[model samples]
Target: MSQIPKIPRRIVTGIKNGRSVITDDAIATNVSEHFPGLIISDIWATSQMPADLSTEIIVENTAFPVVPANGSYFRYVSIPPDKDLGIKPLEAGQVHPLMHKTATLDYIIILSGEIYMILDEEETLLKAGDIVIQRGTNHAWSNRSDTHCIQLAVLLAAN
Candidate 1:
């Protein structure tokens, strides 16, 4: 299997003594492997709407909730090729093992490589620079290419 690339650096800015300053600038560390070769890096989060900027942003290293109640989540995901993970192509009238739903509105941007967005009854190929506004739905991502597919996603809690 090919190696997954490192997560990108995160730069955060905030007010310091009434002047804007770079508060955090470093490679993101809240990374986890959900599957054999699938990686997710939780970059940041907010616990409420009209987020309080006065408070320090503390990114927790614990397992993140799928959809934070009345909050938002920002993360990057790296999906390895399905073949490398021993996942075979779906047969007709089949459902992927990873097909699931979340109570969040997801904004996804493909950062590199390509992947297939598998819907309940259809699928579409997404490549670098492609964007997806995924409402709460049952879906899955399948990477059939030879390399990893990296994507940046922001999930907002939905009613």
Candidate 2:
């Protein structure tokens, strides 16, 4: 199961003041250089999304869409509150596999707990702030910690 981080929301300025809007193109370069070992502030999304939606808290009850045209946005489909992900215990000697998605770019971040990402048949441990870039690759999340492993997921769509 994953718990979304509670991020403070910020008021967007450009759209109201007739100032130049920060378009997606301006940030495309940043995105390419942003993931994979990127350690961005928790305020990252707060600048773009409303305070209510800014939280990293992901629950199955909420499903939002991200429009990548003018820019990029994140949406989450939270896991059901009462149900558990039934995360299997990740042993040191274990190798796990997950299904692959061909059309999307997925960025996974480990939050409060640790997990092993089984990517392309290789196992890697990911702790807080570690990022995994997955593109058309098969992967799985294996939790080794006794506590529930929480993760943040961001999807960047083609503009």
Candidate 3:
């Protein structure tokens, strides 16, 4: 099992009566776990409605939505390394079958280590600093190495 990193506390500062003060400082989120090494954390989300600064946090416990509702704000996700990505038989280029699709557009960035972005029958090897813009498609992430691969994925509502 991969040891997920500690999520930083979100601190919201504000001005009160001409004085700056921290209005909210706490760990806020709604997390979803997929399988053993896969995780999705919803840092914060907003709807199409007008902004509400007074709202501290909006909790979401639903599975990754097939399609984000209209006017919904984007969702940020932190992807930890796949500790079991390298568990394969002694065969070359033997990738696992962990493919799925989503309706929202996703922007994924490789923060550390290398990973394979598999789509349909094709795969692309990506390393640190690499980026992938996933537009409502089927795909999966494979870390074929022993080290963990950290990634940041931002999902936005699709038309």
Among the numbered candidates, top lDDT falls to 1
CA shift of 7, model 2, Å: 8.8
Query: Which digits, one per residue and each the tens of the lDDT, describe model 3 over residues 23-61?
Result: 878875566655555555565555544545555446464
User: Candidate 2: where is the Cα deviation over 4 Å?
Assistant: 1-14, 19-84, 87-98
- How does candidate 1 score on lDDT? 0.85
Error in Å for residue 55 of model 3: 4.6
Off by over 4 Å in 1: 56-65
Worst 10 residues of 1 by lDDT: 56-65
- Candidate-wise lDDT, in order: 0.85, 0.42, 0.63
Best by TM-score: 1
Q: Write the per-residue lDDT of candidate 1 for residues 10-113, one digit (tens) a residue.
A: 89999889999998899987887777778888888887887777654455543334655888888888999998778999889888888888889999999999
Q: Model 2: per-residue lDDT, tens digit, 5-26?
A: 3322333333436656632232
